[model samples]
Target: MGYSEEKLIEEKVFKDPVHRYVHVRDRVIWDLIGTKEFQRLRRIKQLGTTYLTFHGAEHSRFNHSLGVYEITRRIVDNAFASRPEWNEGERLLSLCAALLHDLGHGPFSHSFEKVFDLDHEDFTREIILGDTEVNQVLSRVAQDFPKKVAEVIEKTYENKLVISLISSQIDADRMDYLQRDAYFTGVSYGHFDMERILRVMRPREDQVVIKQSGMHAVEDYIMSRYQMYWQVYFHPVTRSAEVILTKILHRAKHLHEQNYTFKHKPHHFYSIFEDRMTLEDYLKLDEAVFLYYFQIWEEEEDEILSDLCRRFNNRNLFKYVEFDPAKEYKKLAKLSMLFEQAGLDPEYYLVVDSSSDLPYDFYRPGEEEERLPIHLLKKNGEIRELSRESDIVDAISGKRRTDHKLYFPSDFLEKEKARPEIEQIAQILELNLDNGTI
Candidate 1:
């Protein structure tokens, strides 16, 4: 629908939780969303295990994909389309890139990628460049339209303006997810004055820059990002579910490796177990299929598998203790031995989950895959980095903060409460047994 007269007769709309209404006008955008590959996003939850913690967080990637497109649409169409430097030819490419950005995310993407060493970006490129309906629909625009879309998503497009619009420290994708996720999770921290930010956004030679007047709004957005990472993204209960999910996959892989006969063979996981997951193999595995397997594994002969499956299905999550890995290595080692002695495989049972956040972090002179910094353009046309212009963001500029948690089954420990080793483990961590917590 680029530079053409064959546009949709009427615009379509989707009622969105964050943006209110997501408007769609391009025929190409409509067709790409209808592709079977894109529709698969409907089955994959946006926050994976977070739904276990926030019941309202049942929204899927499809919900987020549409939100991203809507944000980008507003930014491109209203914010920068009429600018002298804005290239009209790149409009469709930007829309397509935003729409298909997360098309390759697998079921429980973070856990799947961590366990299987799969890069969703690689698959995103493959899906767009390979033999698929997404590619076919994108190709209808032009022979090289798919490649252009891929380039934008990959952040390798010659047009820095396009890349910055989608992948910057503050961009449509992040903007959409922050509010969308907060809305679904029933949190109030992610709200920011996005309308003002858009009004003040200007395209620079190298990136998107905000007017100095909107600096306060940009700072608010940064603080909101920091809060969400701590409050929502790094919730202990969600990570507990992730730990159990990871162990389930690990136990299944181990069983397959040892030639342990499963009552219900996990044919769906064969390719993943071998580390040779094809696109078809990846597509076959969704949240539903995973739940199906977890249900069946609950009855498997192996105690580890059966127990973990039941734990995940019943929300019997592992209890965690705030741990300092640097100072508690020996304590952790002793706990592992105690877990093994208690008949809980330390490898699968004792999980150390770490989450790190770099608030207001941006691209350095020489850093790998560095994110471009947010800039505020002054009234006199001079620009300054966001940290220099905002006191709040400056407080923790580019500093990485980390939290480590030790997750294990408290029920298992309580069952062996009388054991000397279990008592020692509790004493080592100074467990608050009176309150039934660590």
Candidate 2:
């Protein structure tokens, strides 16, 4: 058998809580799973700092990657099999793309990316084309096979159908993460009829379309996404942990720039701090390495660094109140000045975090971050955008919802409540420090 056609002696099955069982048989996929770079996902989290709010959300990207591959397998092997629209030759390519889509996520994924100005998508492409175990496994199939997979992940592949299987708004990546994250977080909001959505999926010349019969299921999925964003993804407690984590990274980077000596030197972060991080330096980082530093940094000499690390390590997160930047810029300025007068570092202590989401959208080419909207195929073979066909989808189709919160160490302010500055800060925040109304 050719490299692409090879199959394992027996199927390898991983027991999964969300999908029941994720089976692997293709030789290329089996080998890719064994590669060290893929195994590294077991140590990285799927939802960074979310576990601080939802303790059960400790699952890793390994679990999610396998789930995505399994969903794609069901779609190709069951739904699209022998269909003239879906080329059988693209089966393995779709599977490979689905499996490796999130291959480059780092520890504390989003927060780390923000502080370092790093993009996981770029790192993912590098891992596939660079001199690495994943590259070697993919090269066995074809010299350009690694590049093909990278392009699919990059959404630049010529085959739009293959790209839709992973990159589309309703693709395998979102399907798997929504269900898997809901299961691990023990929340009811992420629950949707994924089985029905998978069954109704049809391959189009340029994108995936759903049968109109499955429009209700698709609506449920969209609403689930909306609820999850507010209930879990943007939970204030989770955002609090994220704020502290971001400050920790910023403090470390600043200290590195200041030539501050450390008892527990950040050897793993040196390359990143200097803005010269290589692939090897990146692959060496995981939650374990970061948590180790956080535990030890609690003892560092710098008060800000030590306090922040202590809070993260000990779950003493910051408290937050609703803040609207557009309507209350003056209020925010007053709070910042009062915080400074009370000896609190406004840069780290006073933080305004905003989260926004557009539940669904129709395709608009000129808009920023253009998304190919979900299309539904009617019984008469007419195709229409989902929002136009379904009232529930239309209600929130193009509307963008944004929320902002101002985070601070309320305990710090409470200790000095007798001071005039602290009193003014508490009044502005609508926080009664005397009675602990925060």
Candidate 3:
């Protein structure tokens, strides 16, 4: 149904833990959600292997999709409903962009992207504009409707207000994911005054800005982002899982390149290795399919592949200790030789995981690709960048924090004969032997 005239006879509601309730009033949004492509997100974990570390984080991308749609709905109705700066005609575009933003995300999104050199953003655009149910649904609104939605998602839509609602620093997408992720992970750090923030959010000439009164809420939001980055997003154990998964794919590709016969054909991964996957083939993949492959790969003839698959499946994650990259590289290189002496291939057995993030930053004068700085609307009608007005934001602005860890299978080192060398290496690295060391 085109925007000209279409309405659902009854409203639909999804009980969401983060948003409480996700409401659907339009038949088009409802139909789009029911499509096979959209339903596939139900089988994909939003945080991927992070669930292995945070047991409560089992929520799916489908849950997040609804949360995002709900957030967008609220922003439209509560924040911009009667505002002259916000065009009522752009409501559907905003909703569509929010609902379908992560549509092209494959299983274990970032890890998959690293292993396969695939860009989820490109695929997202393709899914919205390609020959599929999503494209067909958008086309029903108008011949150019799909392109319009794509432009909004790409942040190139002529309507700057509409683009900002979905893509801004404090927009609905980030607001939904942070709160939703925190809810699923059972962590309190992600909680912020979303209601207060939304209430104070007003449309400016070409973008959205928070009122001066909501500056604290914005600071809290930034702090929440900082904590989530350190505690959940860049957790070393999660990165260990990622490292192992990446190695597994690398090993599989290596084996295939060497013409080693696989006991079970990796049909799903064939196109991935060849870099020729069609949208249809990519859509067929989800966490379930990948997990199934891992289960089968555990019995593979290759020891490295089999071991990695087993570790990933059983959650026997690599043990890690803090490492100083600049000072420890030479020592780490020597440790690799020691591992080789002990018959463990350092390439597959030892991993260095480094995670870095910028919690907040101010706009640099000539920075090529800087974020649109968060602006606060003062009581006197003057706009000031957040860090300029808030001490907390100022303290952390443009500051980047990073962590480095060295991961290895400590259980392998426990073998009686290898214990001495392992202990010596651990001592040399000044690794903590306490329970929290891992």
| Candidate number with greatest lDDT | 2
Q: Which model, 1 or 3, shows the larger TM-score? A: 1
| Candidate numbers sorted by TM-score from highest down | 2, 1, 3
lDDT score of model 2?
0.90
How do the predictions measure up, each by TM-score?
Answer: 0.95, 0.97, 0.93
The weakest ten consecutive residues by lDDT in model 2 span: 357-366
Q: Model 1 shows how many backbone clashes?
A: 0
- Residue 68 accuracy (lDDT) in model 1: 91
Tens digits of per-residue lDDT, candidate 1, 331-382, equal 8778888778877788998888887511223323223535567888999989
Name the regions of candidate 2 deviating beyond 4 angstroms: 356-369
lDDT of 2 by residue, 340-404 (tens): 99988899999988884212233222235467888899999999888888888778656677788
Tens-place lDDT per residue, model 3, 180-256, is 88888888888899999999998887889899999999999878776777788777778888888888888998888
Query: Between the candidate structures 1 and 2, which one is better when assessed by TM-score?
Result: 2
- Deviation of model 3 at 135, angstroms: 0.7
For model 2, state the Cα shift of residue 70 in Å: 0.2
Each prediction's total of clashing residue pairs, residues at least 3 apart in sequence or on different chains, is: 0, 0, 0
